[model samples]
Target: MEPEYWDKNPFKATAKAFPPGFHYRPTTLNKTRKFYEFILVDTNSVSIKHFKDPKDPNLNTHSTIQILKVMQPRHYGSNLNQPKKFSAPFDPTRYTYWDYIDAWTNVFWHQNNKYKHSWLIYFKNNTTYNFPNWFLQWWNYFGPIPQIYPEEVQQGFNQFSRMFNNQESRIPADLMYFSSFALSWIFSWQYRYGKIENKFDNSKAALDQVKNWFQVHPEFLKPADPETSLFLNKKSQLAIFLAGSKSKEILAKNLKEVLHLLQQQEEEEKPSKKKVESSDENDDQDDDPFYQNEDDCFGISLEED
Candidate 1:
């Protein structure tokens, strides 16, 4: 039988078209308006049709190949609802299929909607399965999957940081610095309030990472430049404030010392107004001796006499 006929009439006409004694009955459990499922009588053979309207005999079958070419045999007992037990206890050393499920689901949830399609393509091209593991894992978690573990997030952050650091030629240094700064602040806030138990500790750890980044690249926090220093100071103050009540005092103290150092550096780099005025006066005196020794009542230099 031609697949196009099957696509046009689905199981409706296919069951009747089959030779006499061939048993086929539609299964209701998996049947939907757009999809039809049928099983052979006295046999385990089953077929699913992605048909919108079986009554329309002229329905286009152009996309039918796309659906049929990828269809795999559905093993009845291997459904996701059926739990499997392994002989040995769960092993952390070797990952089962489930680990990839959790990892990919967490990635999908964290990505922006626009970027999600790229993730879909990446998984489709890279993995053996057409769908991501997380889609199945979602049912096991009983709700939306938990945010990725902190260690995984930290690893991602570090990897991005390294990538940004290496792209100096492609991206401007200042833009990279600002991007990292914004990312650090965002991550710090998320760590504090993203339903983590150790909110304060995680937030502080995130801020500490930002602090270390600034320490390594001091030019990004140039005290003499108001443009750079203003943002640096604001970020530091915000980070300290977000450190929670417990660590507020310690963070405040450390931040105060940093600001004090910046102030001192600013002062040392700037020329004093009084020194400039004094130098100008000395130049005037050297140009005209009379200006320095205001000769008695005549404003004439004694040396000229």
Candidate 2:
């Protein structure tokens, strides 16, 4: 044997090398469910792309990556009267709760608690797409969402709402907290579950969807920075505990004011922080989303959505 270099837990060395808990837990549970849900239509999305090009050895790998980035599903109306979000140019094409509902019903298999096997659906479907073996399981890039319970959903909604109650301002960019990372699923679920699930008109329901979510709690709009640890105010936290309706636009307008204010504060303090986090701060993007990315398919506009 080579020099006996050992520790109490052989696994512990690798685990400790990363942040605490980084390597210790299962992280795939959420994204798998979401993707499976995305492909639930009569003709699944992933099913259409199976191919192998004779010219390029890497064609499969290239195509596989492209498909995964298509993680956000786009649907169109056939005859359902309801159109899918981002579908082909139509009289109207925006995501509605009904389409979402139909998709999730089959995707989740929530009927029998044991349909939990649907969790494997993503892997199967991706393989079903018959992508190059290389990129198929290359790495797990997105996950750990939708495991949200109704309670946490309510809490996130409440946290955001309370921050805007009666205020007129911008909100902290980080007010969404994990939402910046999780909104692809959470915001959709929270609003849909909170407002439109009832027998309500489309426009009215959309407005209410935003409103009712912010109505209960407000802490959700404050900015969070690693340098400054600000706690959610007690009164604000209390309202989350209470049950009450709120107005989203009013709260949102207020929250936006707070965000603007915070943005101002950050600008004012930037001179000093420039000396500190200059190495850590990420490049800010204040312009259009179609900013160039040489790495992606050149013509697919980032602003398409």
Candidate 3:
């Protein structure tokens, strides 16, 4: 369904044939060969209609998009079977959001076009839920999902956080995923487009901002699973510390302390590092601390005992 904000925009449709539930335009890459359609199903998901023939919009495949994670732009291309990998020279820089329920649902569009398509519907279903294990594992190993735009995520979350702040009140379970998905959408097209594409530095800067937000609202990281919630908090903190140590500028007050703590950790784990180093030169992937046992990893011990 179209968001209420569409009625206030200039591209708001006036034609009688145009329904409120459908997008004003198609969102696919090939306008001639394909006719892709989108409709906002709910706050946390969208219904997709993929038409192979431009002449036959009615004859199409149906799918649903439930956003799981959002980050730099990447696509599976025309051959949908291939895995998505970020290649150089990313065109039309924007946050590419991944779907939890469906893989083929991934797409990128100009913010205005997305606005026309009503990418998000402002509806909250007062239900509670938890994230899938695979979803958590994928992001954790790859890299922590940086909050490039905390304000936007916070704004989207405020709708629920504010209402649920009262005693005995609570946010819907589904909103937790929505809050995570909201982080991906909050980005600057102009800044990202104009600046040199330094993914590491920009991501670190954005994540540094997240530390402030986390301090203000630790509940944002609290999922249903206590272990999972703790893991997420630790993962984010570890990612920030790792990013800060490699950077030239001081990110936050705690960063230096965290770096010193990391030094102590390195010193304590010198023997283990030596073993890992001597294991095999071919075992490059093993360098990632995320793959280590979570229970005993330095990541889990970032916070003071």
Q: CA RMSD for every model?
A: 21.7, 27.9, 23.5
lDDT of 2 by residue, 1-305 (tens): 12343447544453445343232222332323333344333234332222233664333211111122222222333544554454333222343434443333223322111111112112221121222222223222122232432334445544445444324433322223222222222111111211212222223113344445445434333444534434345336434533232676666666676677668977998898776665443333323354444446656766756
lDDT of 3 by residue, 186-288 (tens): 2222123111223312232243344454465555543446768666777787786667554455556556777788689779989987887878653654666
What is the model-wide C-alpha lDDT for candidate 3? Answer: 0.37
Best by lDDT: 3
lDDT of 1 at 133: 29
TM-score to true structure, per model: 0.18, 0.19, 0.21
Clash count for each candidate, listed in order shown: 0, 22, 4
- Worst ten in a row by lDDT for model 1: 117-126
Q: Which residue segments of model 1 deviate by more than 4 Å?
A: 1-51, 61-252, 268-305
Stretches of candidate 3 off by over 4 Å are 1-44, 47-105, 109-125, 129-184, 187-305
lDDT of 2 at 147: 42
Clash number for model 3?
A: 4
